[model samples]
Every structure is written in C-alpha cells, then in structure tokens.
Target: MKQPNIILIMTDQLRGDCLGYAGHPDVKTPYLDTLASKGVCFDRAYSACPSCIAARAALHTGMEQSHHGRLGYEDNVPWNYANTMAGELSKAGYYTQCVGKMHVHPLRNYLGFHNVDLHDGYLHAARYGSVPYRESQFVADDYFYWLKQELGVTADVTDTGIDCNSYLARPWMHEEKYHPTNWVTDRSLDFLRRRDPNRPFFLMASYLRPHPPFDAPQYYFDLYKDKPLREPFVGSWETEEYLRKDGRIFDSKTGPIDKELARQAMIGYYACITHLDHQIGRLIMALIEQEVYDDSVILFTSDHGEELCDHHMFRKSRPYEGSCHIPFLIAAGKNVLPDLKSSSTCHAVVELRDVMPTLLSIAGAQIPDSVDGSCLLPLTADPSASVRPWLHGEHSYGEFSNHWIVTETDKYIWHSATGQEQYFDLKEDPHELCDRIDDPDRQNRIHELRGHLIDCLKDRTEGMSDGSRLIPGRPYPVTLPHATAR
Candidate 1:
C-alpha cells in the first residue's frame, strides 16, 4: 500500500456548530459541507483546554493538558517535544511542511517539520512585552512583515480599528488577496505546485482567521451584512456579566455590548468563515489540478471554538459547549481508503489530542507511548467503536476556571473558582440551555460524572480533587509552571 499525501486545515476560534452540515441555520460553509458529505465527521469533538496555546499543545503533542503541562493559555513556553506528528511522518519519508500558526514558543521553532512558512496573526503577547518581542526578532513576525511589504510600513492591525479580542466588526482594509486567509491559501497552493513529488507530503494549512478583529474582506462581509442570523445561545440560568461596563476595548472578556453590535459581529464572523471556505475550495482545486487529489487524505478542524456571545461569553477558555466544541472531519479521496463509509457522523467524544494519532495512522507512521490520543481510524471504519468512555476538559480563566467531564449523553462541570456546579443532558439539550444539576431525578448521574471528574484531576498538582470528592475555590495559575515566573 502506498502512503497518502496529507493536508490538515485548521482555522482558529471557529465554532463547531456554525457549519451548514451541523444544522446551523445561518452560517454558510459550502466547501466544508461538501467535504463532510464525503467523509466522517465527529460530532462530539472538543478542545481539551479551549484556548489557542493550550489547545495547540494537545494537537501538536497528542497528549492531554495534564501530561502536556499547558494547563491554560501560556505564551512563550518552549516547545521541547522529542516526538511530534510531523517528526514521525517526516521520519517515515514524508515531506512535512507547515504554512501558518504553529503558535509554539520561540516563534521560529518548527517543532519537527522539514520547513515552515509561519504566519501567526496578531499575537499581542509576542508583539508587546513578551520575550519574542524583546529579543529583537520582530522581523520574525511573518504576517506583519508580509503585510508591511504589501501595504508599506504603516500597515497595522489597528488600521482596521478593531480590538484583537473584542467583538467589534470590520472588513479588511486592503483588497481580498491581501487578507491573511487568502495569503495562507495562496502559500499553500504554491506549496502544492512546488512540493517534492517523490515523497508523499504532509502539509498543514493553518489559518488565523474567523478569530477576531472580525476582519473579513469587504465583499465577504457584505455577504452577511443584511442577512438574518440566529441569535446567540443564552441560558435561562446565565448571568448578565456582559452588561458590565468594563470600558476596555481590546480585552473585554464579555460581549453583546449591544444586541445590534453583536449581530454585526456575527455577520463579520460568518463572513470570515465563508471567505475561508472559498479559499479552502481553491486549495482543493489546486490539489486536483496537480493530480494528487485521488491519493490524499484531508482533515479539517479548528483549535478551539468561539463563544460569540453565548451565555454572555465572547472569547474561549470556558467549559461550555460553545467554547470547547470544535469541528473534526476526515475525508479521504476516491483512491484512498475506499472502504470507509461516506457522509458518516461519529458520536464518540474526541479531542485535539486525537489529531496527531489520526494523521500518523494515515501516514503509516509509529505513534509513541508518550502520546495519550488514540487513532480515530478505527472509529471511522466502524462508527460503533468507542475510543473512551468520557473526556475530561478544563481551562483557567479567572472567574471562569472550570473542569468538565463529558460523554456522548451528558456533561458535568465544576467551576473551581466559584464552587458552582452545572449539569446538562447533552442528548436532550445539545445547546446546553437547561441546567439539570438541581434535578432530583438525576442526582445519581451527577454523582457519577463528578466522580469521573475527581478521577481525572486526582493526580494533578492543583489538588483539584481529594480521593473521593472535588475541591473548589482552590486557585491555580493561569499558566502551568507559571507564566509570570517565566
């Protein structure tokens, strides 16, 4: 059997339920929907840590947060892994290359790829006071330098007048071709055209859009400006934290500053996704034109999901479905993996950690014992196959510090800082609106899930649990190994 070329497409902060195939009533993602129709889609995929840095740690290392040591969003921590998915594929004679957003520390660190054309967009930490900024490697900020090259020295993220983390909406200041999403696709197509054909290639086309600054091209933004959008998910028991007047523009933790502006942000967000979808279409066409489409395995997913005003939350790092859930699709071309079912949806609870093993499996490469993720190929072949009974996920975000135990049917969450517990019947309320923690009939289920959470954290350093019960309000650092101490 011949090894297949692999293409991994990742978008940052994209919600899992926003796609047309996922029954989203508003957002349009034709390209992704088409790919999902021909492949296996994991309906319960999630980001273990629900933030860029920590989520990527799981994707890159194939290990859970507890083992990877990135308990939360910490930037500039060195990526010192001895074995990575790309390294394993490269060792097995695959030409590995990455085109965008590695998000590893030291910015230039390629992990184990043969080459990298990096474009990590608008990282405030790396741009301001972080070590990568202070070391005078500002030239290493590839997207910034490239933008300046095209628009001169005055080109800046602020030129769009939108905060990186805020829900403010705007169109790209320049032409559509100059957008980072388009640039990522352009470089990826260039790679497809120039890749070494002798060896099967592993290419990662990572995009840093549909994230924030809500800056899609004007035409793309126009696609949804006047269109109706579904209102954000708001729970009956949810608090009104978004109503607080924080007055901070760039880093406002809450959103829906006004319902009208929030709708505009939704327009921008959906437009960015559609624009990215079009770019993905172009990349696929390039592959077909290069005559490699029939021998390729293409996987598409996001690092984590965006809240988009869900339960008054704007950004990620929460335990809610809107923050943690993400899209996971694996599509093999006609000549590759012909035995797998088409248009199948797997209900197993998978996570970013599963990606490394899946890709390695496709490449016929060895997975190290250090990896905690299981290969998803078995589940793809037999949809009834179960990977694990449940998945444990959490993140540290001030008041939102939370840990969750999720299965195919229900979820139990523990907010460590507030000692608040919430339970939802995922089978009944996939939107997670009705909290059932207080339901008398479900006490036993809640206790069982809480026990699962306790077992998940008993071995960790934060002392999240005693032998038999959970401990709340026990504070832990946002970054393990402590970012401030670093």
Candidate 2:
C-alpha cells in the first residue's frame, strides 16, 4: 500500500456558485467543473473566519481563530505553536512544499516541512475588489523584486492605485508581463517539473487572485465582457456594504455600485477565477503528463470566499454565504473514483481547519492531537456524514470583533463594536435578505446560537492556554516574509 501524494490548490476569495459546475450562469469555470465531476463537491464548505490571515491560521492549525489567536493577516505564528500537519508530515518524511501566496506567518519553514517555496506574498498588492483608501497600494515593486530575483519575470511592480485615473488609462487592466497569478503558477510548474515522484509529497500551490484589485488579465476581461451583473435586493452601499468595508471603500459612497461597473467588476473577478482554474488544469495536466495523476490525490479549495456584492459587500472578510461558503472539491487517485462527485453534496457544516487533519489522514501520516479540526474522511466518504450541529468562527483585528455561529438552520453573528447581533434562518432565507433577529419566534434560536458562541469562545480560550487577545488599532507585522513586498 503506497502512500499517495497530495496537491492542495487554493484560490483566494473564490465564491461557491461562481463556477459553471455550481450553476454559474455566465462564469465559465470548466476545469473546476470537470474536477468536481470526478470528486466530492462540498456544496456548503465553510470557513472559520472570513479574513485572510485569521482564516488560514485556523485552517492550518485545525483550531478556530479564538483558539489559535493569530487573529489578523499581520500576526506572526508563535514559534512554540502546536506542530501543524505540514510539520508532522515532514516528521514522517513526506516531501512537503508550498508555493504561491503564503498569507500565514512564522514565514520560515517551521511546519517541519522541507523546501519552503515562497513564491508570492499576500497583502495590499494582491487585494482585489475595492481597496480602501487607507490600505490601497498602487505600486507592487516589492513583488517584482522577488520575481526578477527568482523567476526573472519583471514588471513595473509599482502600486497602480496611486493614480487611479492614470492607472486605468494604461490600457491593460493588469500588468501584462507579470501578473501575480501568472508568476505563482510559473514557479509552481517549475517546481513540479523537477519532482521526485518516488517519494510521497505534499504540494500546496496557493494563488492570490480573484481576491482583489478586482483586476484581471486583459484576455480574461475579454472572455466575459458581455455578462450580466445584478445586485442583490437586500444589499446597499449605505448600510451593510458600507459597514462591511470598515471604511475601506475607495470609491464614492453616494449610492450603490453602478450596475455596469458591477458587471465589469464581476467579469474581471470571474475571469481571474477562470485564470486560476486553468492554472490548476495545467498542474493537473502536469500530473497526467508525469503519469502521476493516477498515483496522487488532488484537492482544490480556497482559504475563504469573496462576497461579490451579494450583501452589497465588495469583498470577503464577512460571514455571509458569499464570503464564507467556498467550493470544496477533492479528486482522489484515478483508481477509486469518488461516488459523491455528481449527485451528492456534503451538508456537514465543516471548517477549513479540517483540511490539515484530513490531508494527514489520507497521506498515512501521523495525526497530531493538537489540531482543533477533525479529519473529514467520513464526510468525504458519505455526503450525509453527521455534520456538526453548530459551528463557530471569529476574527479579531483592528477593531473588528467578528464572530459567528451557524447551526442546522440558524445563523447568528455578533459584532461588538456596534453592539449589533444579527440572526437569519438560512433554511428560509437562503439569500440572507430578511433579518429575523428581532422576531419573537426566532428568539430561542438566537439564544441557542449565543450559548453555542459562548461555549465556543470558552473552549477555544481554554484549549489555547493563552489569555484572550485584544484587537489592535492598525495592521502590524502579520509575521510576513520578504516575498510579501512583491
């Protein structure tokens, strides 16, 4: 019984329904759809947190944000932190490697993994959608510096947002020669081509697109120029959308996002997603070309999802379905094709944290007891795996005390700064239009979710063995690497 290799493909801020397989009307995610047809499609795959750093930390640590405490994109991973799956797998002698946008900290290879390939960094430069005035960087020279040093692919690398008018006038929506996604995939292919297939390996190829700047390559834009973009009836820039930004909206807040501009933006975003899907296709092709596709297992998902104006919110970092519910697809080796690929969907409200343990289990590596996420093997085997009755997520950074709890039917959110509590019955309001928090009939559900939320906080705090952390006023060191500047 030889151990199988694992390839994890992460696309930043991808939504579930945005793919053709997921019933996307206009967006053509053909490769992803094909991948879904061969494996399990977790229709309701959930993220522990919507923010980039906190969500990834929770995912990798198999712990909730409340437990791991690396709350923002800037907090560095603690040196003494629990050994991650990468660390444990490396201990078991797997050839573990990572490429692309590494948003987590302790940026060096502390996961006990071998060969840390820091290809692209995630921060302001990679942020898409509407980059707020405060955090937007028009120049990305730092990213280019590393690209030239390593891949020799060069671009102006300057933050383009500095002169929006001038930047838009440049003709190309994205840098033609060296888009970040292209660069990441380029290096990843290079690494894959020189693979030692005899040994078991874990390869993480992460991409930071469809995440922000809402910028897509010119060709991708051309691919979706005529798509229709419709804003949700329940969303508005004045309220939920504006609030979600936390004052990050760079454009005027006079009214809702223009319908055509919204359409254009959606086209760009979907195009970027398609671009990413093609990259995965290339990697998968590489596997087939190398005759390793049948010998390996490949999983494609995202750290979290992006809210493309679903709640009128421009990006992810919110607990809406558009942001937290990502597409989870797994393609087992060519031999034992998964049964639930087509007619089945995992209803279990799972978290990204489950990834680490699940990968370890499948790889025949020793699963450590430190992670908070359980192995998702059962769910993968059978779509109706008894799902968690209730799930919790949190992200504490820069005055954002975002925490959420979702049960079989109810979704409750707690925002401390505004002293607001929101409740929605997902069963009835799939679009999340009606807020039933004030309804007397839903009081019991609210109370139940609140109790679960408290229990979750307490459990994570106790398990973490650290005092609760305070949200900061500004973004600081996210325990980032030198490649992030690129």
Candidate 3:
C-alpha cells in the first residue's frame, strides 16, 4: 500500500451552511463546491466544544472534550499532551509542517509539528500582555512581522481601525497579496518546494479568516457587496435582537442594530469565504504543478462556526447550530481512488476528533487505543455504516453556558444556569427557529432525551446529574484539573 500524503486545511469560525454546496443562498464558494463534488462530504459534522482552544484540543489529541479536559476557551494553558496527530505521523516517518493560526497556549508550542511557520492572526488574549514576556505572545506574530518587514513597522491589522472581535466590516488595508489568507497559502505552497520528498508529508494549512474583523481584500469584498444575503435564523424565544439596539460598533458582541450595518457585515464575511476559496484554488494548482496532486488526501474543515447574529449571537462558544456545526469534506486524489470515497455524502455525526484517526488510517499508521474518534474509512466504503448514535456538545459562555445532545432526527439542549430546556426536531425544523420543548405532543420524546443527557454526564466529576435526574444551577468548570491545573 502506498503511503498517502495528507493535507489538512482548516478555517476559523466558518459556518457549515454558508457554503455553496450546502445550499447557502448567497455565499459564493466555487472552489470549495468543486472540491465537494469530487469528494465525500460529511453533511452533519460538529464541534464538541465550540471554542478555539477547546475545539482544537479535540482535533490535535483525537479525544472527546471530556477526555481532552478543555470544556471552554482558556488562554495561556500549556499544550503538553503525550500523543498528538503530528507527533504520531512524524514517528511514522512523515515530515509534518503547519502554517497559520494554532491557538495553542504558550503561543508557540509546536505540539507535534516538526516545523511551524505560524501566523496566528490578531489574538486579543495574546496581544494585551496576558502572556509573560518570555513567551512568544509578547512578540509580534510572524505574519504581522513579515507585513512590517515588507511595508514597514506601521503596518498592522489596526491600520484598518477594525476591532478584531467585532462585527465591523472592511477591506484589507494593503494589497491583497499582503492579506493573511494569501500569506498562509503562500507559505503553505512554499512547503511543497521545501519538503523532504523521500518521505510522505503531513501539511496543515490553517487559515485565520471568515472569523472576525470581517476583513477581506477589496476585490473579494466587491463580490458580495451588492448581493442579497439570507437572513440569520431567529427563534421565538430569542430576545437579544431588540434588546441590543445600540452599542459601540467595533467591540460589540451583539451585532449592529441597524439593518444596513448588519447587511454589510454579512457581505464582508461572504467575501472572506470566497477569498479563501480562491486561495484554495491556488493551492490546488500548486499541488498539480508539484506533481503531488494525484497522490494526496485532502481534508477541509473549520474549528467552529460563527453565529453572525443568529438568535442575536455574534461569536462562538454557544451550543446553537450556527456555532457548533461545521463543514467537513474528504477528497482523495486520483492515485488513492480505490481506498477512499468520492462524490459521496455521509450522514453520520462526525467531529474534529475524527480527523486524526482518519488520516492515520490513510497513512497506514497505528491508531492509539485512547482515541475517542473512530476512523471514518468504514463510512467512506459504506456511507450507511454506523459511526455514532449521537454527538454531545457544550461550552461555557457565562449565562449562555449550555450542553446539548444531537441525534439524526432531533436535538436536546439544556441551559446549565437557568435550568431551561429546548428541543428541536431537526428533520422538520432544520433552522431551529421553533423550540418544541413545551409542545404537548413531545413530552415523551423530551423525557427520553433528558434521560440520555443525564446518563452521559452521570459519571463525570462535575456532578451535573445523579443517576435519576439532572442537577440544575451547577455549571462545570471550563478547564478541568487534567487540562491545565494538574
């Protein structure tokens, strides 16, 4: 069996339904659509812990959120896991390299990558003196440093006057070539020229766009500036829309009150997706030029999804579909066609943790027993193969802290602080605009789901549930002792 080269391309805060292949009404992602047509698309993929740090813990370690020990976003925590995706691949004689946003603690813990040309774009936690001076966070990121070296020290993301964590939209301050998206693509393609060809390579091209600041290059912004965007999903129980009537535009977690500003923000966000798609096209062409296009296995996904004002929520760390659901596709090149599926859709619930084992299986490497994710190869061979009966997801976002369990046909969510419950019939109400918890017809279904949720958490140290019932008003800590304390 030929050892296949692997390319894992990840985007930050990209929603699952925003892609053209996903039937999005306005977003133009032609390159991604083409890739999906030639690959297997996991239509119901999710992030277990819908935050940058915690979601990545599941991705790198191939463990569930409970086992990985990060239940929410916590900065400056060390990433000292014994086994990692890159480390295992490297041990199997693969050259591992990473480019762009790795939200790992200590700023520059290589995790398992042999070489990392990092470009973590505009991390507010690392920029505000939160990390010590000895750490890499105190210094400028590689992309920012390179931008300054090319255009002088005055060059910065602040030049656009857009806040990194806001709904404010703008074009890049400089040329499109200097944009971080292009930088990631550029450095990633450069690796193709520098990699040791004697060994199979594992390259991670991680792009930090479609997240916030909504900064796309001017040409990309123009692509969606005049298009009509689909409105965000609003539930009957949602109250934040009218409550957030006014606030500072740059730093507001609540999106703009004005309809026009919200529309523009959507335009900027779509532009960023299309811009990223074009760079992906460039990457594909480079792979062809290097003559490795037909011998590689390429997977594309996002860490988590953005709310974009859905239910009046703007950022991540929520249990909603717009925050936890993400896009996942696996495209096998021509040389590996016999071992992988093409132009197929898998209905099973897949998550970030599955990527490590799937790639390891493709590489003919050993999969550790501690991995919580199952190899997706069986599903590729038989789309109806059973993977998981249900997927559980949660995150801590102050009062919005929630835990949820999703099956193929329905979803159940519980708010830890308020003891509130929401049930959605996914098959009938995919948008989740109508909460069905209080529906008299669903009392039995709700009871069954609650029992499942309790069973899942009954053994945990958080004391979320006893064997008989759920314990309300008790929220689990964001970071467990196994995560960073111990």
* lDDT of every model, 2 decimals: 0.86, 0.64, 0.86
- lDDT per residue for candidate 2 within 82-138, as digits (tens), equals 667677777766788777665544344345557655533434343456644433222
Better of 1 and 2 by lDDT: 1
How displaced is residue 77 in candidate 3, in Å? Answer: 0.9
Report the C-alpha lDDT of model 3 over 171-280, residue by residue, as the tens digit: 99888899899999999999998888878999999999888778998998888887767887888978863436643474465667777777887898899999999999
Assess every candidate by TM-score: 0.96, 0.82, 0.97
- Model 3 segments beyond 4 Å from truth? 136-140, 245-251, 337-339
What lDDT score goes with residue 26 in model 2? 76
**Models, CA RMSD each:** 2.0, 6.5, 1.6
How well does candidate 1 score on lDDT at residue 177? Answer: 84
Tell me the TM-score of model 2.
0.82
lDDT of 3 at 453: 86
